[model samples]
Target: MTAKRRRFVRDNGLTLAFGMAFLLALTGQAFAGHAEFNNELAADGLAPIGLAAYLASSEFAVDVTENWQSEYLQFFLFILGTVWLLQRGSPESKEIDEAGPESDKEQRVGQYARADSPHWARTRDWRQTVYSRSLGLLMGGLFLLSWFAQAVAGSAAYNEQRLRQLQRPMGWGEYVLGADFWSRSLQNWQSELLAVASMAIFSVYLRQRGSPESKPVGTPHGATGVES
Candidate 1:
């Protein structure tokens, strides 16, 4: 590889690794889900669908969107929550004494912005205001979009099963208000919340030598927000 390409990979190793892992895991899920779907079709005396057909089905769409929505919701809530809420000794949180948006000087925005600071960071107008909350906003927007997709796809899949059983298919409104949608949504939400809580609590007592997610090995338990 070229020097520049090597430097690029080294600088973005974490994101690149996770992005590749996500694709691999998704591929694995597709194959597994396709097999399970075909098994159900066989048991129902219906013809088995091809992998491409299964991938385009409402079942697959709903499954993918439900997980995507939940993950985005986790990030959205975490980004927003960490601003006002804090843990005493967790590296996952800011210092216990710091809560809410600090002054422009503290954030190095406006008059306090360094030469290398982003343009919006130096602005004193609405652009700065919007840019300040951009990350959380984007995550929240993605969550809403994916959750809507999950609901629509889940409704279609549910109605498909209903039609197969010779039952009446409900409207989208009814489907969204039904037990299945809430069950799917809440199950993922609970797990995501639990994970964030676990990470915060665990980081307070555990050490990871080089990971940003954990405190340094010799860091005291009372030390909050001291990343390695």
Candidate 2:
């Protein structure tokens, strides 16, 4: 590879790795989902859909968005919760004394900003305020968007299945309030919350020698938010 290409890969190795993993997993889901969907069609005496058709179906959209919404919700809550909540001995939290958005001087914004600070960090206006909380805003926005997508696509998919089973199709509002929607949503949500809880609590006692996610092996358990 070229020198510039090597440098780019080194700089963004983590994102690249996960992006590739996401693609692989998505591909696997598409194929497996298609097969399962076709099996349902066969049982119902309906024609099976092609791979392209299955990929574009509301069933696929609902499945994807259901998980997406939950994942975003996890990060959304984590980002906002960490502002005021501190977990002693957990590397995922702030030091107990640092619970809230700290002073401007500590954050190096406005007059206290260094020469190399981001442009918004040096500005003293609404723009700076908005930029400061942008990460949490983005996570919350994505969660809402994906959750709405799940509701819409899930309603359509559920109604289609209802029709196939000789049952009455439901309106969007009724479908959204039904057990199907809540089951799909809550199942994904419970798992995400558990994973986040595990990460925060596990880091307190775990030691991953060089990983930034864990505290240094020699650090005391009482240390909070100290990345290696």
User: What TM value does model 1 have?
Assistant: 0.98
lDDT (CA) for every model shown? 0.94, 0.94
Residue by residue across 87-205, what tens digits does model 1's lDDT show?
98899899988899988899999999999999999999998999999999999999999999999999999998888787999999999999989999999999999999999999999
> In candidate 1, which residue pairs get closer than 3 Å at backbone N, Cα or C atoms, i.e. clash?
none
Error of 2 at 151 (Å): 0.6
Q: TM-scores of all models? A: 0.98, 0.98
Clashing pairs in 2: none
lDDT of 2 by residue, 1-228 (tens): 999999999999999999999999999999999999999999999999999999999999999999999999999999999999888999899999999999999999999999999999899999799889989999999999999999999999998999999999999999888999999999999999999999999899988999998999999999997998
